[model samples]
Target: MKNLLVSLADLPAFEEIIDVRTPLEFADDHIPGAINAPVLSNEERVIVGTLYKQDPFAATKLGAGLVAKNIGAHLASTFKDKPQNWRPLIYCWRGGKRSGSMATWLNLIGWKAWQLEGGYKAYRGQVLQLLETLPAASRFIVLAGHTGCGKTRLLHALAQNGAQTLDLEGLARHRGSVLGSFPATSQPSQKSFDSQLTRQLARFDPARPVFVEAESKRVGQIQLPASLMLAIRAADCILVQARFEDRIRFLCDDYASLFDYPANFKTRLSRLVETHGKVVLAHWNGLIDEGKKAELFAELISKHYDPAYKRSSQSNYLRLSDARPLLIDPSGDLNACARQLIVDFAA
Candidate 1:
């Protein structure tokens, strides 16, 4: 019998594999390296689902017939003239009907096709297991600081300076806050997050230090795997500090469009109030409403971000303070900082 369950370690060797699930299902999560060539389009899947709920026998027969016709046409157009040596792995939700049907069809047409044993679900389980086992040998350096302290920007700079860096927020498409979601940018599903992280990590040497931003257990809707969290906690820290005014300026420019929208501004402010108590919130809100964004930021820094930062900083093994806060002065370049850091660590 041919192998069905291929490890991610084995995926690099196989170049052609088709994910035969609905696009929405594929988007939610999928095996790393599998390209989605969904057997049923989103609309067709919905129609079949409705029929399955209403008339099981009729839906099964009709769905199978339609699926067969669609797959035949797809193979004819896409795989025609291909030799018998052509091989492609196929998978659906559970490696049951959909992938089985497709694999059988490909085999009948003289192609070497195999279906994943448990399909996407099995792949997901494997990913979770790998994540659970990942901490045993990984080394990390967490980029930690208060909100708007330019930690994410600094990570990019460090990457440019030849540090192995994982841009978690960038991968998740989230800024790791209630107000972090940008317009038209949705966070990836947990599955996609794992896939993206795995791919990025594969490029780095585990024996070397990898830099990552300090994050809570969750980044937006997605949660970090437990093993990854353990790795983060065990990692060394490089704390970045900046002046309050600079942080506020960075926040304003970073979210200029959101600040420009009165409704969005109020909504985000309200969320802050809900998080930080009404009395403290009222003061900040009054300052914002009075068009004193600077004052508002000062109050928030003094009341919320600073206190949190102070507590977190006490846990850090290393800290860097820029007298001429880089957030305000673009001249306080990260290149020099990253170089100094690497040399200091090396020494």
Candidate 2:
């Protein structure tokens, strides 16, 4: 049984990785490539847990019965197509009873199965540790710009042209600002965000510059790893300069969906009342009511976003004052702008 255990360092050797934790546990975070095959489901885990507090033996008996049933179903359904020679790595929360049961059953069934030594908990520890150190190790080029300077577009273009790029906003699923939320889309949990960031960092070559957006400490509901924030703050910066009119057009194009949902857009903008005052919020909301999107966007950029950006960029980014200016005409070829950026920083 001891010989059946594998460490995180052995991850890539396994062809398949299965997580046996509850679905809720898996959703919060899991190994990058691992698939969820819970021995106890979200609701069932709670039942077992509540029963355990009253009687350990009864809880164990009930859990065992459920685990056995679940594993049998997985065998017939999920693992039905696997050949006898198929090998897989499986884990649970703590690499204890849950994973042990699955591994024992799979091995008995003639398919070689390995249990992750410390389970998802241990994998999470490794992810946290790597996030703490990896960002500092990478050569980061922070792309700094005001609200709608096409930073995200340029980041995508850079990636298309074979440059190493980290799109933090993409990972967080939020634009890192007020009104940055995607329509009907929620951001990942903090742990999930960290796991995603760690996996992306592992793929990047430290010697080559990794271009990333200069986001603040938080992106939507997900807070960035402290080390990553520090690295971005200390990194060399590229200040994107875009025409104000172009920025308005660019934002309208980028956030067109928000315009269609005027009520949602106004609701998002309402969050700025604390910082921008009630009068300002009312005026902005009125613009939405009056269908003056372009004018409202201009006011938001000039009166709100730009001033806030100036202050934060000056104070937070250590190298912002000396950052190389990259003028972008949002109406023009963005891919060309991205290519120019790569050439400019390829030293």
Q: Tell me the number of clashing residue pairs for each predicted model.
A: 0, 0
> TM-score per candidate, in order?
0.84, 0.96
Position 269, candidate 2: lDDT = 88
Which pairs clash in model 2?
none
Best by lDDT: 2
Candidate 2: segments with Cα more than 4 A from true spot: 1-3
RMSD in angstroms, candidate 1?
3.8
Error of 1 at 50 (Å): 5.2
Q: Candidate 2 — what's its lDDT?
A: 0.89
- Per-residue lDDT tens digits for candidate 2, residues 1-347, read 44398999999999799999988999998898889999998888999999999999999999999999999999999999999999999999889999999999999888889999998889889998999899888889998989998788888999998899999999999988888887789899999989999989989887789999999888888988889989889999998878889899888887878878888888898888889899988988888888787998899899999999978888899999899988787557878877877887775
lDDT of 1 at 20: 86
lDDT of 2 at 256: 77
Name the candidate that leads on TM-score. Answer: 2
